[model samples]
Target: MITTSRIRVWDPLVRIFHWSLVAGVAANLFLTEEGGTTHQWIGYGIAGFIGMRIVWGFIGPWSVRWKSFWPTPSRLKQALRPNYTAASSDNITHTTLGAVMMLTLLALLIGLAVTGYMMEETTRFWGVDWVEEIHEVMANALLLLVPLHVIGAIVESIKKHDNLIGSMVHGYRRVQIPPQHMTKHVDDRA
Candidate 1:
């Protein structure tokens, strides 16, 4: 039987923020009526979530902190190395491209929220066609990004032999422990 050690990589707050953002964006995109109260509230909630996440990135656990996954030049180089493989690494966190995607998504979401709010202020932004156009373009971009994110998660999960989707849902990930470390736990049990 195949087995691995599980670690609490994602804290509850991070997991909740992730799924809540997903639901909010999906609802706004596919379910809520445009320019309605429900849609506005959902957008506000998404904005709030993003705000909280930015704060948490500074104070959260090591695994969830910006330092851990931020796209630095060296880190990006490592991630892009020809021989680099998620399956070969014990630290299974965001890849370089994943980090870039996340940063881009955050910026886009912020832009969407700003444009959406501006579009509502008729006195200030009335007849502002460019604002509406930017909002629609960003929304479409998000729609495209969501699927690419899922596909990348699936690919990494398969390569690493871990349930990455479940990790987000349950806040845990199967981490590979070195054989030398395994003996200490076994001896303690005996």
Candidate 2:
């Protein structure tokens, strides 16, 4: 059995943002009445959450920062390669594929929010079928992407030997440190 140490990866803000967004999205999709007051408020809340995340991505901790996991060409290639090893240094927090997924979801949510708001305008975009169609398409895309996100998280948790779902909830991850890298102390009685 391999022993590991727990590290604080996701901060409170990040975790809250994640679950809050999930609840908001789920409520908007499944529970809330479409085009109703509750739905519009939830949509606005999601927009606000996304806006905060954008700002936080710049000033957040190393784990949540965009620079830490942004999908560069090299990183994307490394992540997409077959039989990739998670022990590598590049596999710290978010994988390249995870980065791409995050960005795509954010874009979709933003588009959905914009179109939804436009649909409610009833003046500038009144009777515009395209706006409603675009909103539905984005929502459907989210239905597909959310499952992919969950599957990817599960796969990565198993591959990395860490409870990623728990980490998202509790903001911690069990990190395995190499034996050689463990701190050593010298004895004075030589």
Candidate 3:
């Protein structure tokens, strides 16, 4: 049996934003070829989700803040060190590569949504060649990036000997060292 500390690391809004964005991406990718009202709605949904994520990065929990995810050169080096492979269980948040993945996904999503909207506007002409080209480019690029993201998650999970997928679902993970060990370490600094 595994026990996890009840630290509310991921706010409910962040989880909702994550899964909703996943669904929106899937829907937009598979359904857009048919070109219907549903596709347009999904595009709008993706845009809304991305917009909320930008806002949440500013106002969300400290763990999910932009500063937390934005890797400085030094932090990136630290993250690349072998120590990350044996990360103490309490530090299960996104790593440097994970941060880059998030930013890439955000940019791709926004690009997809913008091009999709512009491609549909009559005044802008639904048949604008550049808009269609960029949409196709961004879509294919994102599809390639998705596999990389999955591989990174799998790699991190394997290195840390933890069920990363399960953690995302349950919003908790058990550490080998007790939470008290971490809390004590923090207290020593204060």
Candidate 4:
């Protein structure tokens, strides 16, 4: 392994949002009764987190901002290249594909929150089949993608010899930066 240095990547708020999202998803999927009060409250909490994340994407430090990892079509292509690495001087945060996954997860969370609220709080859609179907589909989709997200994180962490999981918990990763790629870090973790 190349020599690595500690640098902050995820911020504290980002870390909190991440683990909270995981817990909410897990609780609703495995612990709570469907449409139960606890489930609904967790869903509301998740929606609030997503809303804050979206706002933070605008105002957070450069590494956590949307512009830092906005996976445009062309950008996706670049990210897919065999040699693509997050250690790039220009983009040192989430892998581009990870950004895609993050956006998909957030979108699904929003769908669940809205549909769940409609079913629980509104009379017009209380018995609607389509809304409930949409909600279930999104939740199941999360079941599939959440595992993939975890697997990807594990794979990258091992391949890069960096603790991707721990980075989220504590907001730092030990990364090897080639001399040619050295640049001022964008994150303001301190």
Candidate 5:
């Protein structure tokens, strides 16, 4: 058995935002026809989710805050250290690379949303080639990045010996620490 702490890192809002965003992206990317009302509504919903997440980062729990996992140069260095562990991070919702990817994904989503709105709602950008091009590029970029994000989650799960996907789903994570680091006795025989 592993001595671990069951931490409520993801929280309900975070998990809901995560999975709902995933579904909305999938629906917009595949299920719904582009330029159709359904697709446009989905895009608007995704934009809303992103907006809520950004606000949550400011007022939500410490674990989900920007400062917690912003991947600053110093924090990245610490995460990149050879002896780093999940315990090394004050926030487990993202690794250093995960933080970078999160920011990239958010920017891309915002780009998609803005370009989408421009194409749909504004005369200046409506029917404009460049605006449509940017929207397509952003959607394609999201398609590319989403898979890599999944792979990263799998890799992190293996590396940490924890179920990161489960954490996202259940809003809880079992953060295992080495026996020596524990203040109590453990039976980590395996």
Candidate 6:
């Protein structure tokens, strides 16, 4: 229940990207009506934001780095069980499920954007029923996954003793940082 204010943990760019994607995905989920130009635009925006995220994952803060998403079998097992131990401050980032969701949503959003673009073009993929169907399926999956994402955030906030949503907005967390392993300057210096 501690709420100590701290320096920025989520960089401003990361915060903006996070919220933009959230808004875009939420809009994309509900605006699928025929001739919904706004919805299509939002999907494109989400795709762009996701692209930014992929780049950011490569070059963003220590917390949001692509290495953070690197799949570790041990971490995946820990995430699957209830006895998962929180990593040090340096290791504090998406867990296995979080990484999977990030990848899934990225693929789905990109698929939607590419299909939408192709669907509009006169050549190739245009008027292709299967492409349109895949787009719809991915959109529906996004709608289903978003609520689960929210629930996961809530549960993680409670377990980790930090407000996950608030951290994104204000860019900070109050979790205890483990030593030894966190002191490696290899990644930080690169």
Encode model 5's per-residue lDDT on 52-97: one tens digit a residue.
9999999998779898788899878887888887445645568888
lDDT of all predictions: 0.83, 0.83, 0.72, 0.86, 0.84, 0.71
Q: By TM-score, how accurate is candidate 2? A: 0.88
The ten-residue window of minimal lDDT in model 3 covers 181-190
lDDT of 6: 0.71
Supply every candidate's count of residue pairs whose N, Cα or C atoms clash at under 3 angstroms.
0, 0, 0, 0, 0, 1
Higher-TM-score candidate among 3 and 5? 5
Model 6: which ten-residue window has the lowest total lDDT?
181-190
Task: Give the Cα-based TM-score of candidate 3 against the true structure.
Answer: 0.80
Task: Report the poorest 10 consecutive residues by lDDT, candidate 1.
Answer: 181-190
Q: In candidate 4, how many clashes are counted?
A: 0
> Candidate 2: misplaced stretches above 4 Å?
1-3, 87-89, 178-190
Tens-place lDDT digits, model 1, residues 1-190: 3347666778899999999999999999999998789998999899999999999999998778998888899878887899887577545567777888888988999998999998875668755999989999999999999899899899988887888999898777776776654422222211
- lDDT tens digits, residue span 1-190, model 2: 4346666778899899999989999999999998889999999999999999999999988778899889999987876788766545444578788889989999999998899889885688856999989999999999999999999899888877888888899787766656554332211221
* Candidate 2, run of 10 with poorest lDDT: 181-190
Candidate 3 per-residue C-alpha lDDT over 39-135 given as tens digits, one digit per residue, 9 for 90 to 100 = 8788888899888888888988776688866877976787778766435524546777788787888898898888878877566658888888988
Which candidate number would show the highest lDDT if scored against the true structure? 4
lDDT of 1: 0.83
**Between 1 and 3, whose lDDT is larger?**
1
Residue pairs clashing, model 1: none
**Which candidate would rank higher by lDDT, 4 or 5?**
4
Would you estimate the TM-scores of all the predictions? 0.88, 0.88, 0.80, 0.88, 0.86, 0.80
Clashing pairs in 6: 57-66
**RMSD (Å) of each candidate, 1 decimal:** 3.8, 5.1, 5.0, 3.2, 4.4, 5.0
Off by over 4 Å in 1: 1-3, 179-190
